[model samples]
Target: MKPSEEKPAIIALPKARRHTYYFLNYADEFKSVYLDTEIDMSEVKRRRDKLKLSGHRISYIVFLIEAISRVIRLYPEANSSVKHGMIPQMAVYHRIAAKFTLDKTMDGRRFVMSGIIPDSDQMPLEGMQKMIEYYRDTEADEITEFANVRKLQSMPLWLGRWIYRLAMGNLSRRAKLQGTFTITSLGHRPIQAFYPIISNTLCFGVGAIEDKPVVMAGQIAIRPMMKLSLAFDHRAIDGALAADILTEVKKVLEFASESDEASTQGEEVTPVGAST
Candidate 1:
């Protein structure tokens, strides 16, 4: 065939798998909830400074994940997913999982794929930070869920498009590959609260953190503030439940600076491995 007339590449998925896109396309509406909260990061800042001196490193994402775990533990619905069915039943997960994507360099080009931390409600900030760093550096392997995604990306553009949508769009498959809840961020760049897309049942968008004045102990004081935005599947979660979940998440984050002995709000959570 002539170079210009070359056929588009095609990699076929099993009939059973190809139907995944059908279910994913059923989601009709997504509701976004915007939350603005000011946090006291004095303790976190102090710890970060010390950790840098010791050659250990961490970021707000660690604290964000830590807080996320606590909220998922209490709000079982937030950890749940809507089943891909005629009725679209809601499935509440006994274990909580949070998903995110990290940038990776492959062939000198940037690649991003889904990642998950299962049973996240049990992991601490330190553990979450370490996990994030590990995923960022690791290649496609048993430890890396992006291996299949990377493979799919290698196909011809035309073929990759059909397969990618069918594979990633399938809610069931995505939850299995990624997680029930998703988190994405533009890093620490934007100041105003940004509304993130509601692709999954629940999602968190991390915004910039800058020094902003806030009321503390009846006096205005400057504190490092960050913006967090949430998107929820209206079919799976109602506004009241979503609000409660967001409130609890904020509480966990604000109190993240406390010691383990001081995290008396709820018992700590653990990471649950991959699940279908």
Candidate 2:
């Protein structure tokens, strides 16, 4: 192999990424458990296509948020945060907040941002779409959350880390800043699965949908399948509960039909005996 004639380019880290560095530092303290499974998207895709043809378009990520939000409502423990103080405490939220990742370009460079949808279980598909559209349409610097993250980069390193810890280490503060659960997707690319450090008790990663051979009713058939990966904080939730939540989410997507309601409507669930 011939060596490159030109040297590699080295650039300074973008200010927008300071939050990520701080986040990773915090996430490193967690005991994260990873799991991935392929979900058959036959029914979900068919229903989504039908909706699109009827003029209502829903992306896979939004569909997932809708399903997961409801699942969190059913299993409130997954929507919790843990702070390892002398007396460790877990904060179980009554409302479901779904956080989704976004790719934002700032100053000719691409960066990542995220937005949270509050009371996600109560929002319909159309409402969720509108929220997503607002986030995508607005400039990153204009959003308060994104702007604040960028501002952190300008602060002294110790101060920035201190502020981040104060926010992330408190259960109530973390819930407001990071949300109850997170969902990130790379469905536009060819990747199948990946495990990510979690900011909350549960963080789900979505992979590209592709046609794969799957067994249905004792017969092999080609179906459009997507790999769903989950990273759960074992300190906040047990493996059995995490597996149950993942399984429930998988079934919810696989069996979704055109006639099924596109949202779960109800008041927020307050888990019994759960205190902040």
Candidate 3:
């Protein structure tokens, strides 16, 4: 052999030592839940109609932002992650990484948009909607813009992966500070639901609306239903807390229609001496 290719350094460890090393090196775990909720689509539709009159189509994005805000407010525990090799910490960052498609052609390009959520408890729903509309309406321009970003295009796959890991490591706590959640709306497609695949993050998938019987007031009634799948890092949150978070989110969506109806009715009412 050309200069005996120095046999790879063979350093072996005892079984127990190896087991300990592997366990300590493990990153995190993912847990998911499929939640079916009764949501009223009528209000969302009406809002879309109103927005259409204004030449803006962004009702879905507004709804998502509102829903996420409610979830974060009600279940703060879900907005957190475990600190590696240390006791888990409670985080409070009102930032989330939103994934968006760049082009409709070529199987579509994907990118993550961070800092979508504001620092306050209230989110800029209208602003976010406008941003999404701008992105959606100018697909060609966005694609061209991304192409012009030489660094993004020229990075090698392995280098990209390394960069991603490093960035995630540095931003883990900052991103998971307050409203750390992922929402993916694939309901427009045929896919039913997706399992947790992202690392150190809670992922939620919104699926198509279906007709289902759900208890309203005190009796069971048929209503339009949507499925919500939530994936959490099991190492950080317990099963009970995760379930509680999902339960609260369902409650918010289920009553969203009622709230919208009440608001509409209030707006339509004429004051004491209103003109006809």
Which candidate achieves the best lDDT against the true structure? 2
Candidate 3 colliding pairs: 91-177, 92-177, 92-178, 93-177, 93-178, 93-179
lDDT of 1 by residue, 1-276 (tens): 799999988955433232233323433444455554445556656766776687767786766766776767767767766655466565666766778766655555454555787767676556667778778777744445555655655565556556755665555566676577888777556655656665567888777777889988899988887777777877777877777766666665555543542222455533232132
Please, what's the RMSD in Å of model 3? 11.3
What is the TM-score of candidate 1?
A: 0.73
lDDT tens digits, residue span 91-195, model 2: 999888888988987777687778988888888887899889888899987877666687787786678878998878878878778889999988999989968
Evaluated against the true structure, the overall lDDT of model 3 is 0.49
Sort by TM-score, top down from the best = 2, 1, 3
Q: Residue 52: error of model 2 in Å?
A: 1.1
**Candidate 2 residue spans exceeding 4 A from truth:** 1-12, 266-276
Residue pairs with colliding backbones in model 2 are none
Off by over 4 Å in 3: 1-57, 83-91, 94-115, 119-121, 140-153, 172-179, 212-222, 257-276
lDDT score for residue 110 of model 1? 55
Backbone clash numbers for all candidates listed: 5, 0, 6
- TM-score of model number 3: 0.62
